[model samples]
Target: MTVRETAATSSSNYLTRAGRGRGGQGQAFRNCNVLFHILFTLKGVREVASGQLRVLQISEKGLRASSRRKDIPDQFYMCIGDRQIHIGCVIVSRKRGLLDIRFLNELPTPFVGAVAALEDPFALLEEIRPAVFGLDGFVN
Candidate 1:
């Protein structure tokens, strides 16, 4: 299969694992935008360990490289599309190219919709966040 096909498959598998597959809650909000060329969905976001740490399940396209990184930094803002709102999260771990970001605060409900519609779901500063971690960067 081609690289794009593989990436799509990988993203699908991730959604399944997160229980946000074809007909899942995330599917309803999935839409296309013009930022990163990366199609993505917000699987879910919840607090862990008595609300000590907030975690976010995000599935994205083109993550075959960042999954191999040994160290992911902290305090990076996971920006949503071209909006000013950002969720402060740190990459806790990755599985099958799925990112499990640990957020410092619970993501606001309104922000979820914004993020779900983003073509480039993860941005940092003025650039796409994934590229900073050795991913292929934004497709757009």
Candidate 2:
């Protein structure tokens, strides 16, 4: 597969199979704009135990909000302490408490700098208030 196709697959894979498509349906809601709306809405809200919000589960309804609409790419955003950190590739290994995020070729330079500064992944949710409503608010 071409880099673009591979990236597309990797990104959209976050959502359930039903959510993968251009037509209006599934978790993606068949509208990329709607995805961003949800993302921003999420960001606008606040939470009490904001730590859970750190590990962004990239999917149609998750971090791919911007890319899904622009037809760019998909990724997971690790929000830590008021910072929305993007991750191109992530391996959720709960046992290790490590969300191994692999950066894609198209990632921005500024985002690279941000991920580099991350010292601990476990304390991310609390450190990075990625969601507007925060973790507690989102889950509740």
The prediction achieving the highest TM-score against the true structure is 1
For model 2, the local distance difference test gives 0.31
lDDT of 2 by residue, 5-41 (tens): 7876765555322233322224221211111111221
Predicted model with the maximum lDDT? 1
Tens-digit lDDT string for candidate 1 (46-128): 32111112123233321112333333332244443342334444444457644544444443433344444545423322443
Q: What's the CA error at residue 57 for candidate 2, in Å?
A: 18
Note each model's CA RMSD in angstroms. Answer: 15.1, 15.1
Clashes of each: 0, 14
Q: Estimate each model's TM-score.
A: 0.31, 0.23
